[model samples]
Target chain A: MKKDLKFYRTLFISTFSLSAFTFGGGYVIVPLMRKKFVEKLKWIDEEEMINLIAISQSSPGAIAVNTSILVGYKLAGIPGALISTLGTVLPPLIILTAISFVYNQFKDNAVVNAALKGMQAGIAAVIIDVVYDLAAGIIKKKRAVSAIIMLGAFIAAFWLDINVAFIILASGAIGAAMVIYRERKRRRV
Target chain B: MIYLKLFLSFFQVGLFSIGGGYAALPLIQNQVVEINGWLTMKEFSDLITIAEMTPGPIAINSASFVGNRIGGIAGSLAATFGCVLPSFIIVLTLAYLYQRYRKLTVVQGVLEGLRPAVVALIASAGLSILTLALWGEKGISDIGSINLIAVALVALSLFVLRKWRPNPIFVILGTGAAGILIYLNI
Candidate 1:
């Protein structure tokens, strides 16, 4: 909690390098972060690291950004959060900028187009796998409400063409209501 | 104006992208493709491929990619900052409040509900892209126009994913190579 220049520097570098080299996205960064902060730096303990990851997943936006912010805040408060976030986002910003330029140049080329078209099919397959795993995980829990909500959401988006923002809001409300109702019934009993 | 529009569009993506990066795809699709027409369906799919192969989060890679396409470097900066701002604010606030109250039951319940909904959203997005990849926008109506190669690639990709469970980056790379070899002649 000293909040020194050296500490901030180290936090920025640690986050920057971890983010720059890591691929696959938010989930990939978790173990690497643990290796660095919890094991090498000993800045945080194992238990706290788990808690941070949980919070990151539950919160909105990217998990990597959220985890970096939490770790930074835990170490040095608000400024630390800002520094860590900057470090985490910079690499992607730079990499994609160059990529976009090259992509624009070759985007209309038949070969590049063919390659991307092929990749699209593969991407679609991956997305399907993600959908299956996520839906199955919820259904495996045997929660009727979750299952119904999942089906309703798919219909609403795919057929009715409803805005997803509204669906998410309604689902969150239902969840909170379920908890509140259960609490009330317990009290009455 | 374009910069501002790009910023605001991605700002919404960041704000409501509950669950994680994949969960945000449908929302991003809505903003950039559906509403704004900034990128065509093909371009959007290409963006996903690039994002998958790249080193950072999908949301950030998307913001940068879509922004660069629309408005150039300054636009990428605008969109990336927009994407980052909400997370910065929300996480900082949650971190502060979490210090005061370690438990957050309401948030937990909300996440429980949101989880199923997020899964649904991803499924819907996947179906749309799949339809485009195999059948194009006419969907099933244009059955004769369907690309057999795309269908084969999708089948092969899914089989590989289910059996080996290799890293997605490798799967995508392999598929890209397959595309080059298969389509180069035609």
Candidate 2:
């Protein structure tokens, strides 16, 4: 694909509209992106789209932002990446600005407060659901190491009050070490 | 100073929010609620709901809302930029490297290890939110203080989730409506 103004315009519009409209979370935007770029625009191939999604998931930061970066880069290099990010980010920034303004206005309203109080419980439930699904996924992998790490992480975060960044960094280091050790053992074998 | 603090706080959130938006919750809570006292736990829960109801990434939405609360549009811009900057740099570098070297098994391994930790962080965040909702900020000092309505809402939400598996947005909105009805009368 040619990296022209039109191409950049199209890229920006796609990411902007998708980010603006898609609700739920970061994961919800992936299929929509695949449809737009892979199926609709033919900008990216199906296989490469999957790879991009995997990379986005594995990398730090929001999946939507990361995927936009890779897709933008794949299609039009660095400028593409920047345009896509700005597109993806602008919608939420605008929307939330309006929302926070209104929210501040009604911050102390009795009706709004009551509704928010109830929503709080709902949000907590959603978080619990997420925790259950993620924990179950690790357990289902049937890897003792993964299971142990999950337990250890919960204990450290919940009970020990360890800083989360340290936990994540330590987990990543351990993960890399385990992989290196396994690779060496396989070579020896 | 507040703008700088907002930028740095969200910058850390963006840099460390591996996995996805959900994983960022605990880190964001730590920054906004625990360390900065910018938002109480109750307000933080409202922030999550607002993020859910709105479009785009939770982390992004949150930075904007919190930043706007602290400063204004300029503050929102500062925060939103801070949240996106790390991802922009990290992804650009990783994408360049990925094209050169196809084998990234170590990244996979790190993700694998990170998965469990992500779950744990999410769980810890959820538990705190749940505790705050049910027992209030004072904590479980007495049975009389427990908010049975909040507990019931959580149970109802979970039941609806298990049975229908409806989108969480509905559940959140439904609970909000329920709150209005239940509390308005009282």
Candidate 3:
């Protein structure tokens, strides 16, 4: 028991630290996580890591949080999950709180204003990068149905100001139906 | 009671908000702004702008900011945790069964299909952000043609810089300067 606890604690800290410093979310963290959990810790293999990313992306919540929980649980079960979640969340929570407090104090400072403006522009770039990468991945896979779904969703939300939840649910249902239809067709054949 | 409600609402947001942090925005807006009256649409939009400008995931930052605005520090903590809890629980559960179930052909096919959907989900998120950035209240409609030009220029510059692999900080600084220059001229 003591040995297990020690191992979990170490895993928690390492995972938390990596999450804390990661600049971009999701894909950017993939290689880093692969190194720590797969290469260094030997906690999970490469295939498991890929599987985790897939599951994490499909599930609700941040990918980083999902990844941590999955990895932590894989290593040490429920207790591992708790520790990993805390580790991933704590750093950003602390840092953001500090920044928010300071921001409130200096809300009107010109220099700070300038810096924020610059940061906003950078953020736009980051978001663009995220979109570009995701688009490239989908295009590479040549999934026309998925691409159509994405394009449709984007048009709906962008042009009509439709609620996003409805779009996602509708797309998910459509995807599931397509799968079922494919299965039935195969059986008939 | 309000704190609990806040917690539960954010929990729902976290529960269904797949893809990534940005994907949660429209849902967050719907729940917190339209349904609950916790924040006005304008405030929600501003919060998104602030979230984008800040580091960390947009959802968590929005949670903290919105929570702080609605119910102070305690509210902030509650909302933040709520947003994170679902993914935390679900991933853990899935991880346990992952080893045994990962190889099933059905499971593989489903995941393979889900990938494109996930991509679509993310692309929708990006489009939503673009809409907000370009056409929300302070958007091209109100800000005039110059702002539209600014948006186009920024978008173009971003695409070029991304291809060139220049340091992102420079692009950020440059955009800020442009915003300031435009604001000053106006």
- State each model's TM-score restricted to chain B: 0.94, 0.94, 0.75
lDDT of 3 by residue, B1-186 (tens): 978987888887887677776667667876786678887544554455555444456677767777776777788899889989878777666665665676655544554445555555555544444545455434445545334644764576577677887655456556667656654455
Task: Give per-residue CA lDDT, model 2, range B120-174, as digits (tens).
Answer: 8899999988988899777678988889899999999999987899999999999
Over A15-126, each residue of candidate 1 has an lDDT whose tens digit, in order, gives 9999999999988987899899999999999999998887777778999999998998888878888899989999999999889989878988998877887898899999
For every model shown, the clashing-pair count is 0, 0, 0
Candidate 2's TM-score = 0.95
TM-score preference between candidates 2 and 3, better one: 2
Model 1 spans with C-alpha error above 4 angstroms: B99-104
Which candidate would rank higher by DockQ, 1 or 3? 1
Worst 10 residues of 1 chain B by lDDT: B95-104
Candidate 2 C-alpha lDDT tens digits along A63-145: 99999998988888889888999999999999999898998789799999889888888988988888888888889989887
Inter-residue clash pairs, candidate 1: none
* Worst window of 10 by summed lDDT in candidate 1 chain A: A51-60
Off by over 4 Å in 3: A1-5, A42-50, A103-129, A136-144, A159-161, B32-55, B96-149, B166-170, B177-186
Considering DockQ, which of the candidate structures 2 and 3 is the better prediction for this target?
2
**Candidate 1 per-residue C-alpha lDDT over B90-131 given as tens digits, one digit per residue, 9 for 90 to 100:** 877776676676566676688788989999999998998999
**Model 3: colliding residue pairs:** none
